[model samples]
Target: MSGRTRLRGRFQLFATLLVTLVQLPTVLWLCWLTRTPLPLAVAVPVSFPYLRQLQSPWHTTAPALSTYLALGWWAACAVFDVLMLPAALAVQAGLPRGVTWGVAGAIALVLGTDSVLGRPRLRKRVVHVEGLSPELDGYRIGQLSDVHCGPHAPESRVSSWVARLNALDLDLVTVTGDLITHGSSHVEAVARALGGLRAKDGAFACMGNHDYFTDGEHLVRELERQGVTVLRNRGVVVQRGGARLYVAGVDDTWTSRHDVARALAKRPEGVPTVLLAHDPDLFPEAQARSVELTLSGHTHGGQLGVPGVRRLSLARFVSRWTAGLYRQGRSWLYVNRGAGTTGPPARLGAPAELAVITLRRA
Candidate 1:
């Protein structure tokens, strides 16, 4: 290898070692302090395995583990900072100490504030797309994805999301993926909530990875019952004002099979085709199929980002187009940050967003 290449390799190795050192100790310390025997045992065996995966030459798995480690450490630190504040404050008062307690207190305060803050501020991104075929300009498409409607997102939040989308006066509203968390019981309720959305074209959706974890078939049937077209590897041609647009959907990569060729088989020639794939990784396939635009959302813009640095390393491996608009050769990919929160329901720098894309002829 060249000298520069060797230097880069060495720097990567050093970074890996530093990350392992930080993560192993934090995990062990948290396990010890929390008296969580299960986590300790789990952490011990998985530590080397995880580190090995992190150090792997393959970019795919390594970045994913790195992201998991970073997020895990941040979450653990936040928890400890919250739980140990009183004792740390007392210790600080008893002796002259530095501002570690104060720093921890600040993190705890932010965590608490986020917990009670419900949803992050929603922003409408109006993207004007030119070069649309047949003067198919001024077409509005509303996007909502990653609605993990369970404990963190109740029916009320789902209702709010539906209401917001309904008020957008969109030509069509499309939910890319991640409709519900788990269980078939919540599927109907989620569908009912989302059914309130209104658009002249229609509301369509595809299965996400989470949907398969739950009952995918049941969820699809439930959503279809609620007037939303559950497009599983399917395509539909929509015509308006002397112009036609082809809209297609594919299943999640991790779950149910995705057949891009099948989805695009019957699409009309030269019509602007838009695809909805749950994961952004499908962009390459969409581009190969000559798709004009694609919409997706599964990363949630890392859900918790620190400014200036890429938050989710997993997303980087999957797609450079993690959030916002990206060009893949001639095709365009837009990944929404997401409409709702999952798990802890805390968003730091990355706020939830609803994308309103308007297409026009170039």
Candidate 2:
């Protein structure tokens, strides 16, 4: 082999060894701190890397490990905190009252402010277009979903998302679903934030599983009030400079309300049709109905991914197109990782995304 090739191989090996070494201490420390046994100890290191592979591996071994780690960590923390509370209280009672109070106040202020200021981060992704038809070449579509706007994510985060969406200079925008959590208050706030989104072709949306759990009708109305067209198994033809395109939106799958046939019935004949479904599972049905492209964002790309393993092992069972661009025969699907988070406020492996898709005549 040439010297260049040899050097490259050596560098790769060195990098791999370096990563393993760096991770080893953290793994050991986590295991020690948690006071977990050997078999359970392996979970901390293993779960972190497994969450990063959401886009590739279809079947992964991380979810089980992740569950183990989550349970283990929660149990450990709960026990430790419970045990420490009395001791801390006892010490506080014995100490000079004012000194203890002052120290406690200072610590609370620092930690509380840090918690409020260091809010959960949202990942930004800009998918570049390469092979697109010149006629619709520069047509950009911004997609956001699973915002779950609630106590965890306040109005400021929603506003930030709106600003980012507006900055994309998109021709059209779509919200795939899960806009808010358990109430209509956050939904209304999100709607107001999304009202700032501007697109030439206009912004459209569909409901997700959470929307049904909350007040779906109210959320839909609020979105409509904010200039968003909520398409529940319906479609509309958008014309730009004489080039016509069909945009279809479907209901959420978890609700068992998705009707692709109804959505496709309104499409104009022989025009390029795109379907916006909340889940990627609609791809097969969309493809069967001759949809050229399908945009979806339900799975948060396994929000926490393991590095070498697949992210969100549960996703493969749910949808074939978990994240990113995919093809089903002649039809194409682009699954966004979503603009916001879900259950946990923390994002370890998979980050949020804003998918910008450009369609072309193939």
Candidate 3:
């Protein structure tokens, strides 16, 4: 089965148990505290339906507004479950009512603060490579990933993101995929926004799982039409200051279409190389190929990561390489946190970002 299918099965079971155990108890506790039947009726009605709607048909083709609303509603439900599960258990174990509600409320406040105010920002990182050619040193690459440029992804948001990216002069720009959330309808606006990106060597891209959910080939063509290089199991060489750098891109691994060898086969002998991949699952293979660097951005940093601890997201279970920079011997990988939101249109602890990475010869 596909990754989505496996995750869907697990998510459904987790959701069912969460609602049956956690949310239901939270509602009962609120009703008891208020001593009002009205709260009991309103609490369940307002929240439960959204979770139900979001479930099933893992592949969705609904209106953008409704889908956004449903996702937001689901977000609220998820927050409640995460906060109340322990509280509910404590209450059952005869904890004081005040203590139970206080704990739940505190957790809610922390998560709430993150979701509302965690705006997207630029992150500048200096990565040092041992054998980086001096001519290629100081090379800067701007990364934008998981834009999910669909009906729910606004033109204004993308426009501002593009403006910010262009503001940072970069030697190259790489788009790590999920550019179009749905079909070709949103491709034009997304492409228009990214078309503003400026870099000396130009922007390159690779497909993500969401891109292939519909007609992926069309999306690739549209991106190409916008002057963006959509590299699928291919490699290209770009010259910079008398030095040649090899860049390669692979298709999405989630769909079993990624062929690391096919992509690396085109690299010119003895050239330093960088790779653009949508999912980080192929990092091991890239290391085997001795690729100098790899860029990917599918996890969105789990859409909720602990501020101090980067790897504390549900996405960790999916891929050990969730977000941020990772080094395996000589090969290095940096996963972008994404420039757009997908399901809930909200980011909590894990905020969206435009990454600017500078390379230095170590």
lDDT of 1 by residue, 123-240 (tens): 5544444457554677888888888777556778888988887887889999999988766657877888888888998998987888886778888887888899987788999988
Candidate 1: TM-score?
0.68
RMSD for all candidates, in order, please.
11.1, 16.7, 5.3
**Range of the 10 consecutive residues with the lowest summed lDDT in candidate 2:** 52-61
Model 3: per-residue Cα lDDT at residue 138: 94
lDDT of each: 0.71, 0.66, 0.77
Writing each residue's lDDT as its tens digit, candidate 2 over 111-220 gives 32332233323333333323333567557777877777775566788778777778768899888888886666687888887777788889998888888877788888
Candidate 1, residue 303: how far the Cα is off, in Å? 1.5
Model 1, which residues run further than 4 Å from truth?
1-112, 115-120, 126-130, 133-135, 308-314, 317-319
- Top candidate by lDDT: 3
